[model samples]
Target: MSNKTNYSYVGMAFIILVFGIIFVPRIVDRIKNQDITRNDRMSQGQDNNFKDNSKLIFLEINGEAKKVPDFSFTDQNGKTITNKDYLGKVYVVEFFFTTCPSICPKMNKNLVDIQDAFKGNTEFGVASFSINPAHDTTEVLKEYESQHGITNPNWHLLTGKKEDIYKLSNEGFNLYTAQDDEVEGGFEHSGNFALIDKNGFIRSRVLNGNPVIYYNGIISEAEKTDEDGQEEQISMLKEDIKKLLNE
Candidate 1:
């Protein structure tokens, strides 16, 4: 072979050696760690595409997964609903009163959006426990449901004994709730929403390996940021709900 041809061959071999030293380990590591996802399902030997649920986690307490507590309340339709009713279905929970004048309206509006986004899916549902059951009776909740355009059959505006509701909110879900004669609405409750999995376990997407625990229910999806500079989480909640449903 000509000396020029021999030089070209040496150049190609050196380039390959450099690539093996610099890139080959990284490529193998990426494949091993699944940093590189392939669209070829046949090679993976999977019947269906699997969702990346690595970021999703259970809300744990004392090293064990925290599950939803038991409770039974009457829905707007006058039918009884309980934690058991949510089994085999994913749901969202919130503490609200129909007459809330502060953040509850915005919260439910966002929830209504979530309901609409996942419309026609029986496996998805919403649980709204009224903080003021005395005023937010089944009849009142029925009206609020109509006002907010909540058409989901599984979305329940529940009301029951005052103590039970408060206990469920403060003690069970840890979403704050209390009666205040000083507040604008004469009541106070958390403006966050909790996402639950199909098996009645509280679930959320993690941030830096820590569970988010709850989603902001007060922000609107249309708003880039609220007055406090908080971005809306309704979009995140919808995406996470889809992940849990597929799980």
Candidate 2:
């Protein structure tokens, strides 16, 4: 090739290399930044979905959400406990008798774990109603509390009229409680724990009355798989409490 043509080719190659050096990294950086932004948006969307799902109101009927019915009962300390006390507080509710030999022990143990998880948080608490109110008097509940080592001020073991307690269990908490001779522990009641929000509305329960229910104040499913479900529900319950507190 001629010298003039060779020099022209070399000059063109040099100019192209200069342009690539200047623009290639900027192009790559722009693409990288766009990918990061897209990922962030996707992550934010997933987080929003989780928050939305977690905040869904439970026990809705006829387009209206169900809330804890206003009632009065006596706690283990013989104090008048009512719905007013739980106003603006997030708490868990369960139905059990002190003498229960089957599920009540497990339920109470789980509750102790929950109490420990939110040990100092005033906004979180537990309300355990006795289905066997005829026998589960204030003194009896106090003994049960002592046996279980529940020293949290937020925990309340309550006893009240049998009719009132039964109605509250079935109609209010969406839990079953009845005296059955055939059932173990002389009572047939739901073993599930319920989550009530600050407004006294039940936010967690057996969805659609399904038997395969989730318990409030228990660890998450992932933790359950690893730890054989020990304290897993309490971890999930703590997460739910944080969500409500944030809201």
Candidate 3:
């Protein structure tokens, strides 16, 4: 047509382009936020299902269930214990040192109680891995085990090179237990009990301490034993172990 008509058409196209530029990201953002809200609701629902139904959500970290990393260590009795030894048994593994002035006692006590509870149940076992291997030799571990009245053959107190133990805790078990030379000897360890199923996959982590007290002074006492939320956590751990063993 004419120049005037062409300019009018170009102006209309420019207005439409500007409107799209201003609103597109906002629309996209609204859509993204809606998806996130949906996901959050689903997660909460799944958590509720666990609490109400007493079922768990197990994550298969290593393809077909996570396998406990293989490593060899000397037990309190100076006997070598390896991943092969626990092939057909369900086991709970924790990291601690004998003389830890912090959480070790409580964690060990809980472990002791677990060992005692499942005593003579050949299908299940417990292992306490020493974090301070330089000081916690096999002899020291043996003495510590005896002092605690831990006598189950299936239960093991293991000690190896300090580096090896640290690596196992950090990498193999996915529990970040490290030696803090600045933090007075013991170890800066997170109280966690990794439950490995019969097939050697880490199924769940039982928080192994009291929020108020890093250590429970006794393993059984640390368990969820009261009406408090603490008792529920402890009881759930027990139930989970039972379920895993039965599997």
lDDT of all the models against the reference?
A: 0.78, 0.67, 0.63
> Which 10 residues in a row give candidate 3 its minimum summed lDDT?
208-217
Q: TM per model?
A: 0.78, 0.68, 0.68
RMSD of each: 12.7, 16.9, 14.6
Tens digit of per-residue lDDT, candidate 2, span 1-247: 8999999999999999897555544433332233322112211111111222334335444445557899899999999999989988888888889988876877788778767777888888889999998899999999988999898887899998999998887767556678999877888877667777888876642222121123532233344522432333455455666766666
Clashing pairs in 3: 66-201, 106-216, 109-219, 110-219, 224-231, 224-234, 225-231
lDDT of 1 by residue, 1-247 (tens): 9999999999999999897555534433333233112121111221111234554666555445668999999999999999999999999999988878888889888998899999999999999999888898889999988889999999999999999998888778777788999979898778888899999988865443233567778778788457856666777788889988898
Candidate 2: RMSD to truth? 16.9
Q: Pick the candidate with the highest TM-score.
A: 1
Q: Clash number for model 2?
A: 7
List residue ranges in candidate 1 displaced over 4 A.
1-55
In terms of lDDT, which candidate is stronger, 2 or 3? 2
Pitting candidate 1 against candidate 2, the one with the higher lDDT is: 1
| Deviation of model 1 at 82, angstroms | 0.9
Model 3 lDDT per residue over 52-133, tens place: 2233333343223446888899998889999888878888788888878866777776777677777788888877888888
Ranking by lDDT: 1, 2, 3
State candidate 1's TM-score: 0.78
